[model samples]
Target: MKKLVYSILPVDGYYTFSQRFLELLKSAVSETFDLSAVIAPLESVFLRFETAYKRERKSEYTAKLAAADEARDRAYLALRHYLVACSYASVEGYKAAADTLLSILKRLGWSMQLASYQTESSRLGNLIAELGQEENAALLTTVQGTAWLERLMTAADAFEAIFQQKLTAEAADTNTSAYRLRKVLQEQIEMSLSWLEVQQKFNPSDKLTTLIGQVDELIAHTMTTARANATRKSAEEEALEEE
Candidate 1:
């Protein structure tokens, strides 16, 4: 158990550390029924921690937003590429419709490809509006581009919805705050560990001892990395000050 020293564990590393510890506990469930009982409450706490992490971590939030943006971007690109391909079709009416749409696209005076995230949705909205006009709509119907345009509009709206729902910085002040959840997780882990330690002292199982050792190693490695990072950051700050 080695006191499960976690004070030195960095904030960012907390999720991985607790997750490793939880997995270690789960692995030992077949070894002892008592450990499983202790893990039940602890697992609930960790689930909350994970949910909080999605809200708290900027990287996680950005990854979701980026995914939405990418889908919309792909839809836009597919629409353009489809129109370009249609321009060379053998069907005379389809070729004319495609050429007219492509010409309008060029006359619009921009590539409209890989736009900045900030302006992309509105640009997509403008393109959608232009093509959705009565005249362009008729052209799109001939080439069956109406469906692709709808997909682009759907993707654009999806991205805008996600972008507009940006997370506020006050997450830490909320009930679902990762910081608060982490504190609860820490307490739950310590309590669970203490219960297990008492069990081992009374019953003395070899399986429990091995699991404890593995948990100790995981914690020790995490603490070591945290300390090294702290030292490196301090050194960098000192160098900047000297400069």
Candidate 2:
């Protein structure tokens, strides 16, 4: 029986048994004991050591998982805030937004969704390049300014698409889609305001101002039309219930 138990003892268990055997010999110099007496205490010491090691290992693993989870949450929040900042195209605001995005990219570089971050970063770089070109022009002609605006708008659309994809992944519901649509519209309006401010400062002209006004009016009309449609649909549903 003793040989059978020894054959199955793990390496660590054997080490624990040897250490306990020395302690037992020192503490019981005059005592006479059978093999069972020594084996019992050795087994107890091995079990205690094994339980403690497992508990400590579990604690370390849990701490690592918690830290990872917190990092992910912080990265997500930073991304959202960066998008909000990017909606403002002032020179100072744009720089700040870019910095925020770059920081998030660096922190989450090893994330499973690294490709998504890279795509958004590339879009932001393109937008910044277009803005730089506009700034460097000696006199931004109407056609040239319009071209820059178009490029920025395209980049904004792509950025919004990426953001929507993230939102959908987090909350795959009808309300999530509606919320994303509203957010996109809000971002467009904010971006238009920022562009208008730039044109007002550097390329002041009635034509550009009128164009910006028309864009704002169009957005307002679209919102009014959407609300009316929703109201009509609700009434129709109520009438059907009455019947």
Top candidate (lDDT): 1
RMSD, one per candidate, in order = 18.6, 32.7
The most accurate candidate by TM-score is 1
Prediction 2 global C-alpha lDDT: 0.41
All candidates' lDDT scores? 0.73, 0.41
lDDT of 1 by residue, 1-243 (tens): 665445545446778887888888887777335576677898899888888776666555567777897677667667777898788888768898998888776765344533346555556777788999999999999998899999988998888777656535434345476655777888998888788788789977888788878877887788777778656644553444345
Question: What is the Cα-based lDDT of residue 147 in candidate 1?
Answer: 94
Model 2 CA lDDT for position 214: 53
lDDT of model 1, residue 26: 80
**What is the C-alpha lDDT profile of model 2 across 132-189, one tens digit per residue?**
4633231223112334434444544554555555455537532222222323333333
Which runs of model 2 end up more than 4 angstroms from their true locations?
A: 1-189, 201-203
Candidate 2, after superposition: displacement of residue 95 in Å? 59
